[model samples]
Target: MNNYLTPNFAFANMIPVHAQGSRVWDQAGKEYVDFSGGIAVNALGHCHPVLVDTLTDQAKKLWHASNIYTTEPAQQLAKLLVDHTFADKVFFANSGAEANEAAFKLARKYAYEHYGAQKNEIIACVNGFHGRTLFTVSVGGQSKYQEGFAPLPEGISHIPYNNIEALKNTINERTCAVVLELVQGESGVLPAQVEFVQAARQLCDQYQSLLVFDEVQTGMGRTGKLFAYEHYGVSPDILSSAKALGAGFPIGAMLTTDKVAPSFGVGSHGSTFGGNPLACAVGCAAFNIINDQKTYENINKQSQALINELNVIGQSTGLFKEVRGKGLLVGCVLTDQYTNQAGEITKIALEQGLMLLQAGGSVLRFAPSLLLTDEDRQEGIKRFEQACQNFLSHY
Candidate 1:
């Protein structure tokens, strides 16, 4: 069973054979309730009917015509995104990293054209996770990711997250853009304060720097809104989206207003497999289903239910310090007694037929499907409690 593959990922021993709704079965037929949702990519759950049908239908008609020609599905998907969000235009890519790369480039380009090269500096928050590309990794605030990647892209500076004074002190006339995630997903599901977000917008406006929101994890209804910025009542000049956009099909989009869209002129930026028909077709279906009032209501409802259950488990077991997040994107911080053991907890959860994720080494991350059912929630919670109890007993 030695298949040729890169060893980049620390893969689990269990091999998943199939999945339906919120449940997955391994090769040996052990069932596990999904609580990760493919790291927030599977918004509608595994093999959703609408998305599957859309992908299938588009697969028959067209697959890849490249960027030389635009397809109907791409056009429709772009329109849907534009109509729902603050964006006036859209640029498609294949993953969150590409979308973020496009965003970083667009920010620099906009600054360079409107101002000059000296204005190319981009300021991002510390501990923020953008993407894995060299430019994005550099723009990201974590030093661990940027180690040995020099001479990295220049003019990128980092400031403490949610610190308005630090942001104010750092951002100035030469700043090109200030990029941040509404909720820092990889850094323990820390949501940006509303006032802090407002200050960033105001400062960016004052300094004439563009405001960019990396919504790769918080977009497409993950944070109980169509976009997390909507909750803050502030809009970004540029925004990146990918996870859950196609309901598991690979797709990424960088959206912007008309003012900033012209900066990325023809021949300035492009992608070969971006905006393909197959991906856009599924994206269209997913958008239509997610952008409904009922869907938003359901997300808020289920988010509260899940949070309540996690709190109960925490109080009963005394393993959790805090549970914080918006909507379906939840994080449970381990108490000091159980610090830096999030990975160990997930490993034990796996053995108890539960799938989970850890944000760094201290917080348990839960990004479940928006349409998670009561039955799945109950079953998952049961397994999670058992796993937590087992972990406590062992450790």
Candidate 2:
């Protein structure tokens, strides 16, 4: 029983009162290890001292000086992102959707201004999730997200994900941009085959179209690499990033090369609250930590350990069809025998004092904080095994 006015979000009955590191306390004071990591947004974990110090310090000085005349924090963050990645320019926004929206718009604008309006077609892969905005939903692959929103944006087509032939048949010179997620996080934890990505890059190059990578979930060290594109050795002309950018402080950014950036000149695109001082301050702190080489080594070590443990669990109980994914963003793909049991598994995990997520009906998702400790990981595994055992005893 709650008093909030939301018919959209299916609110959980258990309300979290506080969190620290990779753990949360519910209203009843029950402790649960947060394997969800705020759906992969708490990159450095809850209340990392650096983020806390930065946000608090910025809050005391300035919180909301709009994008007109950028602040020092925003400048510092932009410089850091440009220095570390392939981006030559950056645009800040409030969420992943906004960042992606800007990326699409910028691509079309660049194609139109340089090429022509006839080149405005955009191609996205089937089963990929972008964001919830109308334009993004139209560009996104899932039909369910576009069901009620008809008269959707035209000139966008969906092709089978990771199918190079389908991409080859669909993409052409008319295409302005080909958008993709290196790892499909919503439909299931499916990674883009390296060959497919390389083919897409080649196709885009041949057609003179920009390649867009939606790294909203895969960026900021979720994939053991700072950005998933780094894993493939292919670079996108335009990129959208979020989730872990602010380390739970709520921020998103669209990055682009210098050639495509001018398309968003004065009055082209703007956000009132975007590039605000507070969010940028937090983002700067997060960027420094996640972009460090030491962070990647730590992520790789933890990721290997978790992958090994999950495989052992899968083999012993035969509950998981496969354990797949990279770094902290992992998924346990259920076999046909347990295709519809993801919900049950999640409920059981929660009761056992662990939080988990599901990519689809059958994939149990795990996106723990990058800073999740060895102790916490072992405790989470034990609890997870107990939950599976309880379910098996009844089944």
Candidate 3:
């Protein structure tokens, strides 16, 4: 088959034709237990009934009106977010990159309007993953993403993540904002230390800089909480959320307090298809389902079960060095003997009817549904163990 799509992504061999709950079927009718969750976008699993109903109803009503006029679904969704979280205002976008772009711009604009033009620098965590936009990719710590995108945005620098001393030394009056992911999801599933987050809050306050949390991968109950910041007991000035926000629909949001919200005043930033009726309707449904206390409790319970299984697998096979991460977003770090073989293992797992992901080259990542059933969990683990055993036998 001649491929017409861009060559940016390394395409997988399987062609998934259908999915439901925690399972997906390829074109050849082969079934796979989906542990990737569409890279953490499918919070309620594929084709969740609530989200489906909401989308269908909204589709019949209205589709797009742009930002010229406000819609009921958008207003209702925004209110829901504000009521549940620390945000007093919300801005919707089409993707995580757009949400983060709005956040970075707001941080800079807020600083320039309140402080001055000189206070324009933005500090981010080293090895943090933000988004794919020019500004966001620059703000992201990885050099590989920024290799060809130069004359990239300036006034962005990175410090070693969780390094309180480095953060203390680097942030000052010139810094407009300090952006970080509560859980660095891409480079590796490394959660920020509590002390480090607290120090960041203190230092940002001391320097009058905004604290931005990129919760694109950790929001919407991925970490057994509605938001990852809840676990840390700290609040950010600006927060970006996506992935699971719309339960697999393409939607993103930037949230902030009233104090920092004014900087993004009229005509500052906008999105064309953002805050549309269909997307917001789905977002509202997903939020309602995920924000319950029972949901959080179940997520934590399922997370522990998954972790325990992974630990057992590690000990039995001697293939894993550590299993880390919060809630369903888990990472299994390979032992030194299997260095940089995460991708290979993922491919092998695919052959065994298990869908998995790799954070980089050394960490096998799992971002399953928050409501994963025990049956699916057992099946997934069985398939994954077989994949690991198969790989080991060859080695």
Candidate 4:
């Protein structure tokens, strides 16, 4: 345990090794229900045969051909993403932060090219977690990640989440982009109001700024839709998607309409490992599987069931104030008395064979596999209850 080399993540003490569909086996062979899903990256669960086959098949065919020459898998993935979403063009990247970086750069470039330098400010919501990249960390409303990283990029501003009045007041001629997560993942799994999304879109249109949707945590059927933007019915001019996009494989994509696409011309921006064929191949397969209506419908059902069970547990134990979120991305807001126990509960849950996560303060977050079964969902909730009960008994 070298503290100097490793970064400090909250759950540093309890970590696991082997993983399967809805469960993982630790080094000591302790089986745990995996509710965290690698923070919403494992949409189809651990090592699904389909994804395994896709990855193996692609591995034999090709791995990397460099960005100079585009491969079939990359081209196919780009076309599929473009056809499915409001995007006319797609730029592949290696991670969610890279996707966001591309989206941010494109937004700024589009603004400067068309609307002048004043229209360079990027507006995001408070408590929203974009990523750990320097640019993203600064753009993110969370100041904690920005500490000691002085001289951050200027023109980034924060507005209240789900607040239309605040956005209307702040978003003016100088605004270049308004980035948001349809459901704020790191900030307590709060879904944005439909009206707020619409208003943001209208404001972007009026100001000629790009609307960037950072769908890294909510995309690829996490919300019973291929994309959360589908549920809101308000399309973003620029969208960044990652996490489940590759279904456990590392990949990301930034999508934009034709008008905003030209901002990244020949040498404007690119990534060496951005559109690697193997990643794209897996992404195509994952997209096809999660995009189906039946798959999403099952997700909706399981999400409701989990929420109901969590609420019942909360009512009985008086440990939670509320349970809210769309699909598998749920959060249990701890009651005032148990405020400090959020992290403690997660540790207890891990010890009791249930892996969980925390969002914001006093919120126990759950982002299981989108295709999690009814029985698995019940098992996770039941384990979580046991953890809560044990905590209550002790303290």
Candidate 5:
């Protein structure tokens, strides 16, 4: 038994002693392919040489400099974000939840200050995962996460993803923001239909409401673009990014255009460790590497290969109904007969020296490293095939 106090995480039995790139090793010397990539946080892969070097060099210089003082790493990273994307300003936080919290508050504040409190409704897609904070979970659109946390925050509404009609019906002059996931990562890797996303942009524009994209899971090259919005030719007024920003060093950021950024004025909102030097340094390194055109090409190719291979396996075994999502953030939707076995399939995959993640009850989410090597991909698929065969035998 451990001394930790936490809710059930359904942790794997294997305790990894070490990891490098796309592989992990247990204390017992069992090796496993790391396809989960710490739930998509290791965008550059585990202990990437460049990231490790950046973190170490920054550690030798400075680690934490509270929001009281500006830090160079933070400034550099912020500049990079501003230069590369639609954002004109950036605010750092420690996790996706904090970044999303900031985004939510900023949206409300901007609306309240500019348009009045009447325009304060936020609309998010059903089954879209944001973060674990009270405000985030309240606005996350999944009721089960908020069952015991009432009376939850008000003025937030949920809508079926990709239903442009429902979204149009929901948004009025009162709607303050519409938060969306280009690829819904937690429930299943459901990519937003292009038409629906374009409609969202139009609706927000028609109503003068802010469009927020919770890119916490789909950002930082997860979808073959620096941000998933690039794929659809739509951008969010407020974007929340994390998970992979620091490449395992822990960082989050809320980015917005200049017009809406000033709404978050001095002394309005802040965090102590939001722009820590260590996290920023690593984030900068990861951002520079991932922002490269070559990196995007590699991810697109690798993702297509994995998707093709998984479809081939599905066709051969009839185990999955469809494979969905973009770039490395793909999902294999299991056949109805095997829907409830997603967790068990993951466990058996572990037994076969593979690491995988399940989204909701039926979709197997593959959020592996953007730098996933050809060799690791082949090896992981081999392990997964064996695991599938083993699973079918029992079923």
Candidate 6:
């Protein structure tokens, strides 16, 4: 009814509202399973008690403070991140795009300062969706986001994902950085092979280019690790994190080792609302809850459950051609007959009371909350299967 505040989304015609936990109630108050989890930002699900308390406590104490003065919440959150990850330093922002912006800037600055202006080119993988910022958009491989927004920033190159040879061929001495998503979430939940990631690291070293991991979608325990790089046992010089980092509270961060830390000085880069206490406090609470053995195990368990259930449904109906991805990030590839039906199925599933997402053109993607319960997992899948069946029957 109200399109003023909403841009036309791909599913604008049938999208509905009202969500909590693993379920949502639409405008008609019809109950639906929430398999989307706000595109995987709701790691703890809707209105998690821990996050609510943390946000409430911080809100009461302090909400907004200019960056002129440091706050304990931001400091503590940064400290926790540095302690847990490979980062020796951290910069906070309000979203994944902002975090990536910082990462891009830092990488370029490091290269310029250490080498020269000649080493300012950025190499990213094709189909990698970094962010929407001018610099990040150019750095990101997909041109759809950059369409009607050109001319894009210069000196950026894109290589195919998981193509070690292509990456090696493209990332050379003049390259300032190689940006990659450990798992390309929007491109279809495709996890880069370990050898590919490790080789990227080696090539960066060989070429003296900074390796930047855009872990915006795979961070904060979404991949059964605090950061997906941990799984491959290869660390990047710089890393960007967001999405589930705040468990639905908007926050983002760029983490870096000491080697690339000095490039970013005071006034070099800053966000007025970055590292605000309210978001950081909530982020700290979210991180504490997620960065644990039990939490990681839960992610793996729930992910396997969802994947297995979806596979069974796919096999039974032959609606899906393939299943891929890891931990909670998964994709159900629709058969050629069902490929064009992804958007249709999404609409029908919403009508049937189950929320889901799409990655690229031919897959029904699911990025549910990492801590989703087994019962909810099964129920969500059951509802999704029913929606698929209903749509197939209608067609």
Stretches off by above 4 angstroms in model 2 are none
TM-score of each candidate structure, all chains considered together: 0.99, 0.98, 0.99, 0.97, 0.98, 0.97
Q: Number of clashing pairs, model 6? A: 1
- Candidate order by TM-score, decreasing, is 3, 1, 5, 2, 4, 6
The TM-score that candidate 3 achieves is 0.99
Q: Judging by TM-score, tell me the better candidate of 4 and 5.
A: 5
Task: Itemize residue pairs with steric clashes in candidate 5.
Answer: none
The alpha-carbon deviation from the true structure for residue 144 of candidate 1, after best TM-score superposition, in angstroms, is: 2.2
Quick one: ranking by lDDT, best first? Answer: 3, 1, 5, 2, 4, 6
lDDT of 2 by residue, 1-395 (tens): 55678687766669898989988999899999989999999999889999999989999998887766889999999999899899999999989999999999999999999989899999998877889998999998788899988989999999999999999999988999999999999888998999999999999999999999999999999999889999999999999999999999889999999989999989999999899899999999998899888888989988999989999999999899888998899999988888878888988999999999989889999999998789999999999999999888887
TM-score, cand. 2 vs. native:
0.98
The weakest ten consecutive residues by lDDT in model 6 span 6-15
Note each model's CA RMSD in angstroms.
Answer: 0.8, 1.0, 0.7, 1.4, 0.9, 1.5
Instruction: Go through the candidates in order and give each one's C-alpha lDDT.
Output: 0.94, 0.92, 0.95, 0.90, 0.93, 0.88
lDDT per residue as tens, model 4, 17-114: 87889988876788889999999999999998999999999999999999889999999999999989988999999999999999999999998999
Q: Which candidate do you rate higher for TM-score, 3 or 5?
A: 3
Q: How far is candidate 1 from the true structure (C-alpha RMSD, Å)?
A: 0.8
> Least lDDT summed over 10 consecutive residues: which range in candidate 4?
5-14
Best model number under lDDT: 3
**Overall local distance difference test of candidate 6:** 0.88
Model 5 CA deviation exceeding 4 Å by range: 1-3
Model 3 / residue 353 / CA error / Å: 0.6
Clashing pairs in 3: none
The residue-by-residue lDDT of candidate 5 on 1-395, one tens digit each, is: 48385764656798898999999999899999999999999988888999888988999999887988999999999999999999999999999999999999999999999999799999998877888888999888898888888888899999999999999899999999999999898998899999999999999999999999999999999999899999999988999999999888889999999999999999999999999999999999999999998888989899999999999988988899999999999999999988778898999999999999999889998989998889999999999999988999998
Clashing pairs in 2: none
Off by over 4 Å in 4: 1-5
lDDT of 2 at 199: 98
